[model samples]
Target: MTSEPAQHPFLKMANVNVALGDRNVLHDINLTIQTGEHVAILGANGCGKSTLIRTMTCELYPAIPGLDQPRPEVSLFGHSRWDLTELRKHFGVVSDSHPGLYSTSRAPDTAGSSTGRTTGLNAVIAGFFSASTLWPNLIVTDEMRQRATEALERIHASHLINHLVGEMSAGEKRRILIARALAHRPQQLLLDEPSNALDLAAQRDLRESLRGLIADGVGLILVTHHLNDIPPEIERVILMQKGRIVADGPREQLLTAPVLSDLLGTEVRIGEQDGWLHSW
Candidate 1:
């Protein structure tokens, strides 16, 4: 009899702890995520969701194990360490608060900074270097430009190609940032509060874009505090509280009013419309 191939996990963490400055932000985090899985990491502000994302991206390292303690295990694609430049090829990261998304260049004589003035297409191409903007020293080949154009098309932001990122609306800028992340054609995307500071119309548009990505088989690891940010395609939900994961389960089970009320430390009411959940 033939046997099935073993499944390889995209990410795994056991007994992981992270500290920022003097505070230990993540504690005893045990998580396993398979390739192509759609999952949401839900939490309130200050719950360490951002820290966890950083750790996954290798921007932050876990606390070293004590001599008497078992070593903490954290791996991505079964590897414990990665080169950031190469890592961007496999996993794209987008955060609403990323300064690069709003970065701008100033005149050589100017004393103050401004919003990012790079055009959308150039910004996407910069993804290859994991840079905020294309620098004079960077070499962008024809293939890179083509890939950047394709990424914009995939996100339905081709119209934004020539638009300056600083001049685009919040929604437009968000789309450009997403295109930047997609430029490398990564297998999965890690998003942090992607819908933050967006209006009603923009939020709807962002969700539609996300759905399209999911349809194209790009796995998503979405971290957000807003219930509405959880796309319908996401079936698994992991809840974090006080720097720890408190619950991890199917969305239908963990998104109930009582569960959310406890998680948010308030009396919460929820409603569903067209597979999207809203909280009150």
Candidate 2:
């Protein structure tokens, strides 16, 4: 009897190429994450890590191969075709660039002190609508509210339900965003530079919150330049340089001083303290 073909991973891309305007942002990329696997993509700025995540989520499309060439493939949940709305329901994405956290007219330094914005619970509720805030025309059902409330509780954030996002601490606000993503009950969580603006203590809190999610069986995809941002639970690492992946392997193999130094184009000393990775 013939053997059946191997099952496609939950997310997979092979020979993927992406261009933004005239610049080639990603080249010959291949990534595969089986269901329930947690991975990190590490690189310096402009290394195309963000582009790769965007492409994976369908925000950016991979370039089609030339005539007679094998087609570049990107599949989610084992399927090549997707309805954008349905596709998004499978993954929760959080990014520093996410709106609603900062007002367009507000100064950057005033991020956590700005006023008249969505509250923490409301922000999580907005996830149901796929919006930064609930649009006036959209009708919210009672079930949506319950889900949002439960999401906040999952992260121990139910107390912030009534607090304005701009008035909360940076760490608290980030947890609220995580709650927003969890409200959707997605299979995986994608975080892009999650600890970008938090202080050291806040970073610790964020890590703790992420550990809780991992304990709850949520898959994580962490993309960041900061080594500390990679929670210890994520075992696989993909190192990128320029616009290509230079290494992909278990965390222990790829996070050594020499490998990290080469990946970031600078001297990097990596240390582990209390099961967390730190680089300097």
Candidate 3:
């Protein structure tokens, strides 16, 4: 986890607009995720928070115009996304949409032969492979495996290495998903609602994990609807209302009653737990 970008403008957005069918989902949108910033995209359901996340990462919502989503030419590091394949070694994405179907088993077909025996740790391990799990030559070094073990240990998922996904609790699966994300060793973590299904204790663990991440200087952009999900290290908030960013500034400036209450469209009380911001 590195601190700031080696250069300026790691991710830039300009005049971005997206629509779902005839309904306009995103207005003329513009935003940027800085090198050292950890921003949380907050909004009510159907307020286009999820839509914005998909669009920013070049993913299309169901029943959209074409089969594939259209992504603007993004300049990551210094090269365009087209020519930046190798350069993309610096990026990682974590989403709830990932199915447990894909795996890290060197013999995916072998696992396919028998259904229901893969653990969450196994799924997390699968994230290490660049391609599908069916590749004949699957190789992971001892150190990398050790790192994976350490990552799971960080989240208390090490004990679940042998427990199949079907047997593990929801929180366990979520932790594994996060562990998989860390396997990418991302400098900037894009979390698509990391706390969505977590319980209070699990959420606390995630908060601590995020604290550790920022402590090491990794940038993060977490998409969440609740104020509590906003990690303490996050200095800024980008409130999204009706697909466009309504407010963007420091947490102290934007997380106030006037700003957040307006964005949420209801009266809510905000409280701070440790360094995190919470709404009630």
Candidate 4:
């Protein structure tokens, strides 16, 4: 019956469990995410990454049976996260096909060449309503608009404010979506595969941008399948396999060849130099 995401230390999960179609997809999960710390969630595809994402946002299931008795109850700021409205104050979500966040937005009175254009700036504006996209009579005000625009500017997407939804490049769209998430200035950033499909330069840019946010003390939860995608800023990683946690600890302790190889069920070697982690 709490509301906030445990403002005390950070985000914590105690004996969390999740399922899909009567088959448990996640089991007995315990994790902690503190403010200003960037944590990565790494696993093979369908290893419960998305399920964990939905759980953090309180969008997973209404009544995760057995929650009261070690169920997948989500809490933030030392309170239950059932209150969708208050729950968002500390979390921002980004995923592929997040609707208007992608191209093909149906905004009227638009100009030509709307293809691949991202009006994601508007989605940043929609953060006040906790919506993935803008809607009719959505109750926005002048101050809110200013804040949203400022957030876009922070991510250097102010110029794309009026760009058609389908006109921007992949990287541009991604930045806009991040801007939208940051527009609310949530305490924690819940990112899902942030580096997927991004080229080297774009990936570098993303890395550079994250430095500032991490320095600012924002808690970050990132997910990716590649070990290289885990940023240097990430202090901890929780490896998942078959919907269960395999290893969890400091980046150095858990991201090594032995740990990673064990979790991955293969003989893998890990190397790190200058904060970049790679596996072979």
Per-model lDDT: 0.82, 0.79, 0.64, 0.70
Mind giving the per-residue lDDT tens digits that candidate 3 earns over 37-76? Answer: 7787788887787787665454543233344645443344
Consecutive 10-residue window with the lowest summed lDDT within model 4:
100-109
Q: Mark the regions of model 4 whose C-alpha exceeds 4 Å error after superposition.
A: 1-6, 62-72, 97-120, 130-136
lDDT tens readout by residue for model 2, 1-280: 1221124467888988899998889999888898667999999999998888778777788887789767898888788777656654667778765443221112342444333367777777877766666668878899889999998998888889998776778788788778878887777888888897799898887888889888998888999999888888999999999899989999999989999887777899988998888988
Write candidate 1's Cα lDDT for 1-280 as tens digits.
Answer: 0221124477999989888887899999999998788999998899999889878877788898779876788888777877666767777788744443322222221212223567789877876776667888999999999999999999889999987766777788788778878887878788888888789999998999999999999989999989999889999999999999999999999999999999999999999999999999
- TM-score per prediction, in order, is 0.90, 0.89, 0.79, 0.83
RMSD of each candidate? 4.3, 4.4, 5.6, 3.9
Reference-based TM-score, model 1: 0.90
Candidate 1: pairs in clash: 103-116, 104-115, 104-116
Against the true structure, candidate 2 reaches a TM-score of 0.89
Residue 199 of model 4 has an lDDT of 85
What TM-score does candidate 3 reach? 0.79
Ranking by TM-score: 1, 2, 4, 3
- TM-score, candidate number 4: 0.83
Better of 1 and 2 by lDDT: 1
